[model samples]
Target: MSKSVPSFLQNELSGSVMTMYSGDYGGVEVQGNIQFSINYVQKLREFHIFVAQCRDLAAVDPKRGRSDPYVKSYLVPDKAKIGKRKTSVKKKTLNPIFNELLRYRLRMEHLRTQTLILSVWHHDTFGRNSFLGEVDVDLSKWDFDHTQMNYLALKSRPTSSLQPSDDRGEMKLAIRFLPQVSHSPGKDPPSNKGEVHIWVKDCKNLPLIRGATINPYVKCFVLPDMSRKSRQKTRVLRSTVEPVFNHTMVYDGFRQEDLKEACVELTVWDRDKLASNLLGGLRLGPGTGRSYGALVNWMDSNADEVALWERMMTSPNEWVEDVLPLRMLTTAKTVMK
Candidate 1:
């Protein structure tokens, strides 16, 4: 089946935005293929791939049917900001020649758990970047001596056989904690109580349902209280995987100290008229252990989750934001473990 036209959203405050869904890779001629050569530079203990070119790339600009193409590479699971390397953008071309080298410095042991990812994207000037198709090669299965130019057909992001399914998508979340009752512009007075503002900006590359149609929404719960009063959700945005819900959810009547025992869980769901399915979610708090004098599994978060939570808790009255990747939440129950 051919892919549908991508959704274009523009915030007057922020100008034009570019978004591409996971389903955009349906048509081979449109989503396209990337040419590259991979080799291990043994002398420097570095792995490098030369992004040769991208052919028949998708036209991100629906009106013009044009694409400003670029190639980006990452060592899987470490798709962190610092880990990705990109080629210069070739303006308004479906077939762009980059001929750029992207390298990764690591040891032999690290390669055991790594996968080489080469993704082509359409660069949008004003707002957010859009994803095209990609090709993944598990490093553990590759031969370092094979350095011939590889012509591989690109496809949507593939689930890794090496690791558990964690790449559902990414959510842009901005959190602010008002630790005290204070006067701030465009903010609630809290009536002598502290407040937590959850800014659900948007999501990118959300999981696709059948026919590439999804009515996605964001669901939130402030934990230990999984009651109806504690649950809040955003309006479902139809069709697009990159749904922008620039809405804020506010919770009050808590003391500054209470944040230590609190956990904020944000989940992304595909809202069907009949039933909604949980795509993925994230839990933000200090981490696994006792919360409110009780141990719970839902509060179990690590790395980026704990860091983001601590950043918000420490910076009172300031927005502490981060783009956290959504992970597979195992359980359906909202109760404590």
Candidate 2:
């Protein structure tokens, strides 16, 4: 009986194999399940799994080429002998299934070239303390760090430092999301759930080998009064969720040939007990708007692509940037008032 794995992971692994199997002579292929541990290959699979999940978040199918060229496996070819009569080595051709996988790999590589702007939101503890987040990065910068140095060593460079611009095109990313206090909004909502969707142009838009995580179950303390100590003075609180994020850092072929856009429905919950206690229900904090403000400032001040900031603001659909106004930049640090 065959087991089932998620489509996202399948896309991710396919992309990884494409990234690693590059060479001048010919391409590499996978055969039977048995072999020495292909640790690098496994890493590629894990990264795609994460990419698939994020694609789900954005409601995009980042693995669009799954049905295009197809994928297949074959036995490794034996090397030609020196002394014996040279045998005619008929180059093996890719079956339709394998071609689909190859096409997916190429497509993802293209996406890896185009930079994606990721907007991440953190509804800390509860819905009351919601804050904004985003990452503007170019996927062209990605590469194997170790591989770069080794290549540099062969050339006898005085130094083998990998400069930001060197492979920054592969995936140069940055993230900023404000911590907040909020309450749990039960599963259902009047409209869409409080959650936000996330999608990347390609695997390079992600950080590393797998998906990111948000730790929502941690505990904390909220004090009614700092100096006045009494039974009512302290309250147990839910801490910020620790998120584990990952994506395909590299691909075996150009993006257009291999990967697809990924999508997911947002699933954030409201759980701000502190705000509930004070406001009788969940309410936005005074400084909450500042999160977007700071993001805009960063985009204007730090992003090389200024049009990204502008495009985000004008998106017709209420995108993440739309909810996070660029003017929230004026808030002084931490003074939520």
Candidate 3:
């Protein structure tokens, strides 16, 4: 179930995944129109993109009669996984109704520097995905307050080295930074110590151990400090796939700058008596590949995780919550980097 991509698309996507925004409207036929709406809510400081549908799309596979089209999007100049958003594939159809919402959390000033590019593709199970068409929207031209579908003409939009979607279940939680200042008249003047609240509500669609139920528990570590002192765990809920452990792990003595430098790694595991089985986990941080002042490998948070963290960091005392997809872990290596 594979198809060769168009030569032009292959050429454009060769050396890079998507280095667009260079006015490279490479010669591509106008084959479709995408319907989507844009809205910006000031309270949450997030931009919500409602991708409605696509009509009269081109059939790349004429013998197959239609295409397996899906939408891929991201903000320009920052293709870091945190900025990318995608929709599920619609099989063998010329018009796909995708009532999906893609969100990005950022302040107004940061949004101005970015361009939103939404591209359509034909998904191939074993081969490279074929490019269909795309629409690049200027973040400033549309009215942010009102919600109305924009029928943008899809055109030749170069390339995107894409990755297939994964279903490793999702974790829901709330994060908040409550800045603290203590005054005892003498001692140590004043410190910018703050408390980070991570409320692990529960997990949905957890996997089983071996055709049997799993006793799942969650573990947390505020990173750069994966020490024993920083290791915190929640009680295991037995014989359940979807476990609800209304637990909160609080890490204190962190300054305002420390929040910017630190990453939160939360993992799900099956407590087999004294031993453990790794189900999956997620990292919440800036996803910069480097943290503090050094180069490290643990800053692997995706766009959704980064957005949730950014929302919590910017909102200060407010509780920012989101459901983030967990990454599946296969092996329990000697150490986690």
Best by TM-score: 1
* Per-model root-mean-square deviation over C-alphas: 12.2, 23.4, 13.8
Of the pair 1 and 2, which is ahead by TM-score? 1
Query: Candidate 1 at residue 132, lDDT?
Result: 80
- How would the candidate models be sorted by lDDT, starting from the highest? 3, 1, 2
- lDDT by residue (32-68, candidate 2, tens digit) is 1111110112333211101100111110112441111
Quick one: RMSD of model 2? 23.4
Q: Number of backbone collisions per candidate, in order?
A: 0, 95, 1
Q: How high is each candidate's TM-score?
A: 0.58, 0.17, 0.55
By the lDDT metric, which is better: model 1 or model 3? 3
Give lDDT tens digits, candidate 1, residues 1-337: 0012111101111101112223234433436788899888878877788888888787787678788887766666553212345677899888999988876666767865677777787765443467687888888988888888898887766654422223466789999887666567568654556788999999976766556578899999876565678888999998878899998998876676667777788889998878988877887887645455554555566456777888987888899887776765643243222
- Candidate 3 lDDT score at position 337: 23
